[model samples]
Target: MDKIKVIITDLDGTLLNKEHQISDYSKKIFKELYDRNYLIIVATGRHHLDAMPLVAGFDFPIYLVTSNGARIHNPNKELLFSFDIESDAIKSVLDLEIDPEFTTVLFKEDVWQTNKTNEKLNKFQKELNYRPEVVNFKNETDLKAIKMFFTHESHGKLIELRDKILVNHDHLFSHAFSLPYCLEFMDKSVDKSVAISKILEIENVRFDNAVSFGDGYNDEKMLTATAHGYIMGNAPESLKKKLPQLQIIDTNEFDGVAKFLAASFLDADVLKN
Candidate 1:
């Protein structure tokens, strides 16, 4: 019930519905929050280029913390902050034997590159889009990788890989499960909470004045850093069980974030659809 000066949320499973699209009801709720002068921030493991389109139509400023906190962009889409995995670290991972079945995607400044194409990923996106350039990492020399995404059908396999990487290469990068099928890797120092804190500082705000929502292992820090944080009902059981202290809200399929905003901040009820 504390006053909230900023609202931060993850993309794939928090603000976005099950289909990875924003619902009209949520749009209405966000618009009202903007009208009421509530600050908004979108924190995701997505690249800045990929995230830009999803939040663009808001018609209000929404700061972005992308690449699992490796990059930050202002509402105007100006690059405010950025960090990259050291090229040596990039080469080290690229050298490690990864499962051939995994689809590997790389991110840099305005560059989204992948080793292969997987149409199956479309189901998890707002668009059935193949937006990354297919490339062979072995031949690349000059590269700035902010984050690496590895996807597989088995979330459990990805979890195994995450553990393996952390155990063998813990000093090289941080790892997380951004989605059931997606494993994310970034510089060891990258963190969504740290990124959000930077934004809060720029705005002259404090953690206690912000509320955040997320549904991934990558979100743990940001959720704990904020004064109020909630996890979606649809979030993986592991995450829910791991962070029982945070409240669990309705699933994204049911407009969970919007419903919460309506109850906590708006006068009108969000009638169930």
Candidate 2:
């Protein structure tokens, strides 16, 4: 096998443990890899600021693929590439005659905005330590949205909204479920794999030299695009079934990523013990 030059992993369900924190064990392993000159890249559905707390301990610089690949930031947090959702597309989603129970959040270049906050929003804020600005959507215009997220307790309702959007606006957007209750929308051309591809090109690394780890629907393309793709055991069986060729590791709660890395690139004894 070729040496892994680039390491890309998702945050929420791949690198983070059940408590939504990166374990010290994982941090140590990642730091060692960073010290060894491996390029560490975090690709997630999270905004860059929201993803920071989980990765704050690493002293080394890392690339960030945020908003499910709507934006990519360099090690210095400078924007490398971005694909903002069209203003018309944003307006179209805002105009959709959907149930009021569903909560919508719009991500711009720097901040996330929403018109309403609910229990789900509060829970998310508590986990990430970041909150969105509640703004009046009716008066909002000329907004450059990077991604739009919708969440509701009813999975069926979210699916209904997704199908409705796809029916008329499919040409303008790509949609996926980050969680069962969460639906995310991005530009038609945006995805983690696309962003990773661009980053790989910029770093002069081959796709075969990159190893990606992910578990959500948005991660499917990213995992597939790399030569070594790993799906977490906690991933939905449906996702595992879809990509049977990829290896399955332990769940995030068990520090699966760290274990795999130690076994694959570092000391095999880390897993033996």
Off by over 4 Å in 1: 123-130, 269-273
Q: Give the per-residue lDDT of model 1 (tens digit) for 1-273.
A: 556889999988888886677888888889888888899999998877777778876768889999899999998888899998877777777687887788988886765778887777645556423266788888888656888889999988887877867776798788888888888888888999989999999999998999999999999999999999999998999999999999999998888988998889877554443
Question: Model 1: which residue pairs collide?
Answer: none
Give model 2's TM-score versus the native structure.
Answer: 0.93
Judged by whole-model lDDT over C-alpha atoms, candidate 1 comes out at: 0.84
What local lDDT does model 1 show for residue 51?
78
Q: Show model 2 residue runs off by greater than 4 Å.
A: 125-130, 269-273
TM-score, prediction 1: 0.93
| Model 2 Cα RMSD, 1 decimal | 1.9
What range of 10 consecutive residues in model 1 has the weakest lDDT sum?
122-131
In model 2, the worst 10-residue window by lDDT is 120-129
